[model samples]
Target chain A: MELVVSQLLTGLSIASILMLVALGLAVIYGVTGVINLAHGEFVMLGAYCAWFLQTEFGLGLIASLVPIFIVLALFGWIIEALVIRHLYNRPLDTILATWGIGVMAQQAVRLMAGGELRYVEMPAALSSSVNIFGATESAYRLFILGLALSLFALTWYIYRHTAFGLKLRAITQNRDIASSFGINSGRVYRATFAYGAGIAGLAGALVSPLKSVSPEMGTTYVVDAFMVVVLGGTQSLFGTVASSGILGELSGFLAFHSNDTIAKALVLLAIVILIRFRPQGLFAARVRT
Target chain B: MNLTGKSAQQTLLYGAFCVAILLVPLFLDDAFLLNKYSRYLVFAMLAVALSLSWGYAGILNLGQATTFGLGSYCMAMALKLGTVPVHTGSDGLPDFMVWNNVTELPWFWAPFHSMAFALMAGILVPAAFAALLGWFMFRGRITGVYAAIITLAAMVVVNLVIIDQQRFTGGFNGITDLAQFEVAGLAFDAYSSSTYYLVAFCLSAVLLLSLAITRSKTGMILQAIRDQEDRVRFFGYDVALYKIFVFAVSAGIAGLAGMLYTIVMEFASPTFLGVPLSLSVVIWVAVGGRQSLLGAAIGALIVTGVQGALSESETFLESWMLIMGGLFVLVVLFLPKGIAGAFEMLAALFLRRSAAKVPSVSQPAGEAITHGEGAS
Candidate 1:
């Protein structure tokens, strides 16, 4: 029972990270109609930025989050303006374009950081662990889980209640109709893209301390995020959270008993089988055309 | 008559190109360059397969490396098993397997001892796997990004499997220090410069076969599917069959490449089956020009060559992926057609300018000058 509880906590922490990564991917795909292959690279960039700041200037991990998010948000805007704008309405081209961007970003990181996996020192408070249900756990893991869920709730609230969220949704669902409804679709696109990148940045900053901060670290998570998005229904945020939680927990439990590689292969095979049956992902969005 | 005129020119150009490729070893004395070119040539076969599926049949199989690695592993197993009599270590069973605690060969692994069976298995296993995958995917019309995603997943899964199966697949260390062949009384030492020549000869032969297939009517049908699947279906073509056929053919070529790769490198690792390797293959195709068979081969050569060179350099070497990534972006965004396409376009421009200098009387009826442009 204690083992299960610890597994659940681990699952929740991973799911939180996945949620942040998939949130950006889902939003970009929803609003812009582009499967940005470079989304993972953006997350990597954000993590690297925080790592850089932590190492060079010795900034507080929480304080570094602001700069990471802002810088990535601006980068996202520039990507949208420069390359992604032209790739709109062409899904295949977007895949290719973003793939190019991903490649460039990965190489750039390697070049900048000199190919070594650097360690990020988490703040002492964040590093502390607390006992939960007779199982000792890292407080950092719980904090991340809380932060991610709250962020999702915040995003959901904004999506339902706020003016910007509505506009973003409007633009995504039906661009022509949204334009006709007097919403500036362009501004909504830029904002959503930036917002998505910022969320990914936040996740990266959270997870930087846990994992080895390397140029290629993001690719591994991106694959899992892709599986989550595909399984969860690409456009639905709640579905992403649910799928990530389930998949993460299942894989974590499997890895505990079996080899890590076999566990991953099994999860991938399971996802593929699921996709074969349900071509439209689990919890298909009603608004999806 | 129109077909006859174009095909004749194509035959002549291809024939000349083949001769030139065969003669390349005469000018280049470096065994390393020859070995490198041979490796590239093997990849060229793989690229031809990719073009068959991606360029013609519109199947974006991002897991071709899985098949390539399968073939390499098959060859490595054969070589490993062959060395049992010669290098009989304490407790036998090749050095790596002994270390991993396998006293005897696995029951399924016994057949690879024979060269004939091993070679056949290398090609056929990948073909069988691709056939099964293509059967489901093509039957369901899983094209576009979904197909790409599925194949990408397959790549990750295959690499994971290979990495996990430490005893059979050699884990992350992979299979190395295997003996060369004595097939049909020919003593083939992979380490020698002569072996590189043999590899080069085989590469040219494969290139010829690939070219013939690309120019065939079947190839035209495959390209038509790439352009419009619905239209071909309307015309009563077996769309699924064609997709499977192209995919299987591509897998076979990648298998052949892997076989040659094992012979050249004498090492087959899980890295051969990784997502990065598959993605790099796609990059080669995109950079070379998707439809052109020759272009695909050249693209693999150029990209691999550049990577090899850059990776060797001290200062800029560590950051080589950045350079490659920038190149990928520039090529895709600006050079939509690819390096081969750009070069072809330039050649056409020069030819047009040269033809302009000729008098009006020399120009043929219905304009032969415009034919190359439209066909390309």
Candidate 2:
């Protein structure tokens, strides 16, 4: 019972990280219909920022989160305006362009920070383990779970309730119709892209304490996040959450039984099989074209 | 079947390319330089393979390196088996297997003892794998970015598996100190003129064969499908089959290049199957002109040559990726058709100027422009 409970907790923690990394990707791809391959680089930059702050300015990870978000969001906004905006209709070109942007960002970070791995100090308060039903869990893991849920709630609220969210949805449904209804889709897309990038940055910052910070770190996370987003259904927030949970649990369970590498390969195989049956994804909403 | 001015120009260009490639060994007597050029030719073949699928069939297989890596590993296995008994042990097991305490040679590596089997498997395995993957993806109607992501994901999975199974695959260090390729009891040394000629001969064959395939009736239908799949399907073509065919063909080409790569480089690392190399292949094709097979080949040659030269300097090596990334972005943005497109534009302008000089041939000039545009 203790092992099961602890395993579940581990799964939840993994799910939180996956959700955080994939949330921004889901938002950007869902609204803009552009697969931002550079999404991972944004996450990498956020981790770098966290490392920079902790090392240079002596700012705590928690204290520097907002600034990292803003900076990454602004950076994302500029990228969208300059490159992605031109390639909106050209989805394939956007993939190439974003990949190029990712390469440049990775190289730029390597040039500036050197290729060495950097670390972020965990908060002293959340460094200890907490016991639940005789299963000891890291307090940091629990905190991340709570934070991820709250962020999801916040994102859901903004996506469902706000006027900006409505415009964003309007554009997603039909860009021409949304424009006819006087919605400024370009501005909304830019905002959506920025928001998604901000969320990814925040994820990077939070994950930095757990993982080593490096320019190439984002590549792994991005691939995982993409799997989450793709498995979840490209345009659904709830789907993203559910898929992250599924994948995280599946991976965690598999890893417990076997090993990390085998678990990963198995998870990818499972996703591929699932995609074969349902190309529209697990949570696709039916609509008449 | 008519010999139009456009076809004549294409024929001329192909002839010139062939002549240049064939004449290289005559001028460059340095064995090391010849070896390096052979590797560049292999890269050009890879670009051609990518162009066939991506440019013609609109299937941007981001995991092209998967097939290439598989082919390389297959050949590497065969070569490793043929290595000196010191490396293979008294029982003839690979040194890595012996180190890992593997008592027996695995079933898969057994057949690779025959050079013919290794060579055949080198091409067939990747092609078969690609065909199977293509079947699944095309049947599922996973096109565009989704297909690219899936292929990329598949490559990652394979890369991880290869790295994890260190006992069999030689893990991160990969298989090294391979035996030289031989045929009819004649050894082809890596730095020998014969090896260079072998690579050059294979490249020329691949180039011409690909050109022929692209100009065939099936090729036209494939291009039609690229332009409008739904329309082509409505007209009764098996769209999925066509996609799978082209995809498998490209994979086979990539596999052929991979075998040559193993011979030239004399080793196969996991990096051969990694994301960076796969993505670099796409960039080479894009910069060459995805729409033109020969253009894509030239693009790979030039880019690989330049990268080789640039890597000689420490500072340049450090910033090379950044430069390539910037160049890729610029190419995609402004020069979407790439260097080949630029050349075509210049040729078109020259033709128009000459046509204006003699109004009698203006009709042929107009026809040539349309043909050029259509081909591109």
Candidate 3:
């Protein structure tokens, strides 16, 4: 019973990071209808930026998040203004183009930092494990859980009530109709893209301490994020959070028993099977207008 | 002036190009350059395969490396079995397989002992896989971004599977150390340059065949599918079958390249099937010009050459991928038609300027169309 409880908690912790990384992917796909293949690269850059700030400037981990978000946000905006702007009408082109961008980002990181994996130290406060309900969990794991839930609440609040969120939602429904209503669709597109990237950046900052920071590590998570967003249905942010838990738990539980590679393969196979059957994804169908 | 005239000129140009390619080793007696050119030709074959599906049929196969790898493995297995006697143990199994530990060979590895069967299997396996995958994908009416995603997913999954199945297949440490061939009492290794000549000879033949296919009515339909798949469907053509046909044929060509690649490199590893390789193929096709077979070939050669040069320099290795990414962005933004197309456009402009001074060299429109690839 204790082992199961421990496994569940561990799964929850991993799911939290997955949820955060996948949240931005879901938002970008939902709003812009582009998968933002570079979404993982944004997350990757975020982690690197935070690590660089901490290592170079001797900034505290908490203090490093601000610049990480800001830098990635600006980067996202530029990507939107330049390459992504022209790709709005061509979803496949956007995917391939962003794939190129992702490669560029990865190679840029490789060039700057070298290909070796860099370890980021956790803040002292979040480094230790804590006893909970006669079981122990890493303090950092709990911290990540807190971050995920808070972000989930924050995204929910934005989509539910905020004016910018409303405008974004309106654009998602029909870009032509939304633009017709005097909504600056282009600005909204850029801002939403930046926002999505920023969230991924924040997620990267939050998760950097838990894992090794490397340029290519993002490919694995990026693929996981794609699976989560698609499984949850690209139509809804709530779907991402829900699906993240399912996928994360499933994968974690499988990994607990089997080899990590096989577990990953099984998960991928499941996604492929699901995609084959449910091309519309596991969310609301809107006639693809 | 019309399509027939253009086609005739294209045929002549293609014939001349093939002859020139076949005669390369004769003029360039240097063994190193001959080998390099031969490998480039193999890469060009793979590029042609990629262009057919991507540039014409509009199915961007992000997993071209998988098919290429399949072909390589088939060739490697066949050669390994053919050279060594069965049940002799160490001499029988390839070096990687011996290291991986297998008491007995798998049943599938049986037929590879025969050279002819191995050659056939190398091409057939990839073609079969492509046809089956294409059928399922197209029948489901999956198009555009979804198809791209599926192929990318296939690459990841296939790579993982290949990594795991180390028993039957030599996991990451792939099959290597293939023996040389002797056909019809002819020493393939004559002059140490004949091997390269053989490769170059085969490549030109394949290139000619590829050009023929591209000029056929089938090629026209494939290009039509790329432009507007739905409209083509409305015209009462089976879009799925057309896609499957091109995809299968492309996979066969990729396999052929893999066969030659094994000969040139004398080894096959998981790196051949990795995402990096697949992405490089995409970059090559994009840089060369997708619709033009010659352009795809040139793109492969140029990019591979760049990669070769870059890897040799530590500084270039660090920054080259970044430059490639930047180039990708620039190409997409500006030179969407690719390097070959850019050259042709320049040639046309020069021709226009000099038209009054020189007599009109009559060429058919069909033939001229080879040099007229644009974003139509």
Q: Could you give candidate 1's per-residue lDDT for residues A46-70 as a string of tens digits?
A: 8888888988998978889889889
lDDT of 2 by residue, A1-289 (tens): 9999999988888999999999999989989989988989999999999999898999998899999999999999999898888877667888899999999999999999999999999999999999999999999989888888898999999989999888987888899899999999899999999999999899999999999999999878888998998798887899999999999999899999998889989998888777778888899877543
TM-score of chain B of each: 0.89, 0.93, 0.88
Weakest lDDT window of 10 consecutive positions for candidate 2 chain B: B367-376
Could you give the CAPRI-style class of model 3?
A: acceptable
Model 1: residues >4 Å from true position, as ranges?
A176-184, B1-3, B84-91, B191-194, B211-218, B234-238, B308-312, B347-376
lDDT of 3 by residue, B168-211 (tens): 77787777666665556655542357777677677677667777
Candidate 2 reference-contact recovery: 0.57
Arrange candidates, best TM-score first: 2, 1, 3
Look at candidate 2 and give me any clashing residue pairs: none
Please list the residue runs of candidate 2 whose C-alpha ends up more than 4 Å from where it truly belongs after superposition: B1-4, B356-376
- Which model is ahead, 2 or 3, in terms of DockQ? 2
In candidate 2, residue A234 scores what lDDT? 82
- Give i-RMS (Å) per prediction: 3.7, 2.9, 2.9
Q: Against the true structure, what is every candidate's RMSD?
A: 4.3, 2.9, 4.2
